[model samples]
Target chain A: METFKHLVNILAHPTIMLTVGMLVFLFFFPPNDWFEKWNRRLRLNFLWTKKGFYFVMFLMVVFFLFGLTDPNFSLIIKKPDNVPIIGLIFFVFIFLWISMNQALKNDNLIEAGEKPEEYNDPEDKVLVWPDLVYIEFIALILCMSLLLIWSIGLEAPLEGPANPAESPNPSKAPWYFLGLQEMLVYFDPWLAGVVFPSLIILGLMAIPYLDTNPEGAGYYSYKQRRLAIPIYLFGWMILWVALIVIGTFLRGPNWNFFGPFEFWDLHKLVPLTNINLSEIIYIKWFNRGLPENILVREIFGFLIVFGYFLLLPPLLAKTAFKKLHQNLGNFKFGFFIFLLLCMLSLPIKMYLRWLFNLKYLIAIPEFFFNI
Target chain B: MSDKKKSNIFQRLGESQVWKSIIRSGIPRTRRQRMMSVLNSVFLHLHPVRLPRHAVKVKFTWCMGGLTFFLFLVLTITGILLMFYYRPTVEYAYTDMIDLGEQVPLGIMREIHRWGAHAMVITVWLHMFRVFMTGSYKPPREFNWVVGVILLTLTLLLSFTGYLLPWDQLAIWAVTVGSNMARATPFLGHEGPGAALLALGDINFVNIGSDVKFALLGGRFVGEAALLRFYVLHCIGLPFIVMILMAIHFWRIRKDGGISGPT
Candidate 1:
């Protein structure tokens, strides 16, 4: 009884202790030198690249950075309209980022004049009949049996008839769309629900067309198809999957934030004051009352967002991602960078909303548009 | 001599004209016979007549796409069985589900159908992921990937429409939330965009009654009209589209020269 109570108390209060521990450990650690030494010890000389060690260190930083939060654990990220479940997201993001970095390094090496690999017959293959078909059949049987067993153990969920009057608290979409739902916390309906989803589909469909790297065609070779594969994987693992994880577990009553272990309360009414960016700039900064026309007010916002996505790509091509730009050419580079930044803006906008109550950069209620 | 005359009945049947006509080629003695064995049967032809050894390797393919297709077949069979009992009405829908589960013959079929729908989505995702991981989306296979993406969209849409059928809170609210996302569709959505642009005094071009969500629901909100439309889409319309697309996807795979692997 005492131990159980003690465990519960630790769970409830472990937030501060963990934050302190992670911060202290990070402060003392010499990440660069450690990664350098790690390359030799692990002997990633044969297959994997030395970039992997650096990525591992980066993962540690990412892990600890999120760990030192207000929540009792790193997995829970509490905000008014979002509670990001970080566990799976963290793991997946780390995997993606590191794998990408490693692949990039390896590809760079290969590009700078190195042998692709040994001479082996690419067409060497066995018969597909009994080999593939029988395996598929067995897998089918196994899956069906497993599903049947699971069904027998746990029945499918069915709630009472829906009453429009008595709405469920913190009414959420299906688990898959939870990321978008989470995004709704920081973004307008048009941006979060419609624009981003469309963009994601478009981006996915456009991958093969946009990516010109022809090295890894019929196989999985990180070195050959470094840029394309890593970028796509990173987007998939971090942006979509992570957001869904966050939405599913951390979002509680009234879309208030809650830790994974925390219980949902119907009365957890957070007195949130979400202010539009235009409101702050106009009403507070300029000492103006309010604009009668939404379109006029949203003009500044429209320019800013459009300008950011469009202008920033060329600027990046000239500077930070110079190699990428050089490799992909002008059009592809601009397009790729635009998509990347747009995807990145979700998290940025989300954090801003949580930290500073930023509802929308551009709020045009008349047009039912917000950015 | 009498014993010799009385040959095995099975052997005699095997040699009989009735068996010969059906069997076509006797015991598949040659390579041509082996090919004929596959070609002659409608069921066997769904698979390739021959395969590269690499194609057979379980590690290479993971069989997720095949499993997803199989699950779709399962959903179709179970869903048809379920439809015999389920009545899509405000008063009857929920009760019909309950009746299907408890009072109807083989009540478990409904549960399987419900679970199978969920499984199909998951399998499709895994299959798509596998394709991406293998870098099979490059060049000649690029259009196939697009087809795959469309199939994926169709799968999600089908699931979304089906969510409202049970008339339970889970179904209704999920659909409501899902459909609400459509309301934000730029230009075409009622409240989204172009409403102000296209409006001419008393006539708003885009509205709750005319938009995608409205068409999807067949009303202002989820009601009887929505349920009927959803039922039609889930049972007939979406499935028909999905089947055609799937046929294209498979044929493209064959045309692309069997399955992709490390080369």
Candidate 2:
């Protein structure tokens, strides 16, 4: 019993242990040399198709095993809270990785000006009705059958009648909104719930319009779209998915922080002493108290925020993203860069909230504005 | 019976004027007949006659879009069935749901409706992701992509508005947490950013009672009014909007050169 108890104690601390293990493993494991062996094997006549098939099978097996063995598997699926979101996030990442890997393999061929037929579908292609429709119809049947069976077994949750007087201690929005809900902890409600979400939607809408890249159409290729899609998806993972994971597994009652295996306690409060940049500058740099005027006090904040958002386009046009800048002219370039900065701000703010307890860059409580 | 006799019966049926009138053609033996089989049927006209062999490949397309449309059908059918037993009143809503699950005819319809709603949300997201990753939204297809985005938003809105219909704690709190965000819309909410500015010059242009939040909730808080509003939105309003948008979306896919293949 002691040994079993000790095993749970040691094994359940995945976050800390995994971080340590990863650092240690990476320090010794030179990834370039490891890949060189795979390259040599590939040159010795290993088929990429076979390799990819085996690799996917291997991943599926590993995932299946992990699900079976993970102690919190039940909690992850059975949800009144967001444990299922955590599970879905992991699965989503795995599929994303596989998709990226598949896309990457054909990237170089695309760059080398390979014909579309050589890589994927021929230009003069197949029909839509019998070919696509039959498969679609079959898929519809399979999906409906699966959902019906699952629904029969698992009833959707319905608790008692709502009484406005008794709100849940940590009332959650729907699983998708949990990411934004989590953000509300770090930023003001307006910024997290309203502005950032709007920005995400706007950015998504702007993708096809702004991204002038002519390659990676009708097929997936990481090389062809090495810049745009991956960067957007990676940012989405960090900002939204990561936040939801934290909100699901790491948050406890009273919106307190907790480790993965930590028990939720109503009173498990972590003392927060957050200070704004303006306040810090006022006291530390000028050796005086902060001003009451919102305009005077937050001018620096506005400059910092807008400057990063606005100025980066011209900077990119001159430097790292010059090609992109030329591809998409001034208007599109500025808009895209602005969207990127907004997306990037979520993670930046989250880190600041976590590390320094920095509440806001611009906090205007009089107008209920905190950013 | 002999194989020849069976063929004679089928041949006679195929040649009969009545059969010709219905089928507009004889038995489908040739490729042209196979193509006509799709064109001649009103129900089958939604599909293009014969697909490109490439279109059939599951991995390339992932069939995610089709899967989403299929799930929408499931949700619609099941939702209507569930609606037959449901009552939107605060007193009767939750009870009706329980009774529908336990005592009503095809009691499982309630469960199917609930689960199908969840599945619809998942499939819509997957479809959007698949489309984005494939870069199928470029050029003339851009507007279709925009329509797709609107449909996606409608999917979420439908799911959210439907969440409140159960009248349960989960439904209530979830919606409560969600609608509370509206109360922070810049010029709308009493406590929102632009509201203070709007309050100046001895006059208030906007406040909680007269803003987007009020219109959304139908009151200061989520209660009976909110439930009824959500019900209308979920069952009739949003669904009506989505149906029209989906029609346009599908039409545009055909117009935009069919599910974007390798060029």
Q: Per-model C-alpha lDDT, please?
A: 0.69, 0.71
Candidate 2 structure quality by residue, lDDT tens digits, A3-54: 6434544553434443453343222221244533554554522223457546
Candidate 1, residues B153-251, lDDT tens digits: the string is 899888778878888877777778778877778887887865557678988788778888898788888888999899999999999999999999998
Q: Which candidate should be chosen as best, given TM-score against the real structure?
A: 2
| Worst ten in a row by lDDT for model 2 chain A | A22-31
| Residue-level lDDT tens digits of model 1 in A121-229 | 5555433344455687799999889668655654566678867667687678766677788778777677788888888888888888777776766544464554565
Runs of candidate 1 with Cα error greater than 4 angstroms are A1-124, A283-300, A323-329, B1-34
RMSD of each: 7.3, 4.8
Native-referenced Cα lDDT, model 1: 0.69
Enumerate the candidates' DockQ scores in order.
0.44, 0.62
TM-score of each: 0.80, 0.87
| TM-score, cand. 2 | 0.87
Q: In model 2, which runs have C-alpha deviations exceeding 4 angstroms? A: A1-73, A80-87, A90-98, A111-113, A116-129, B1-29
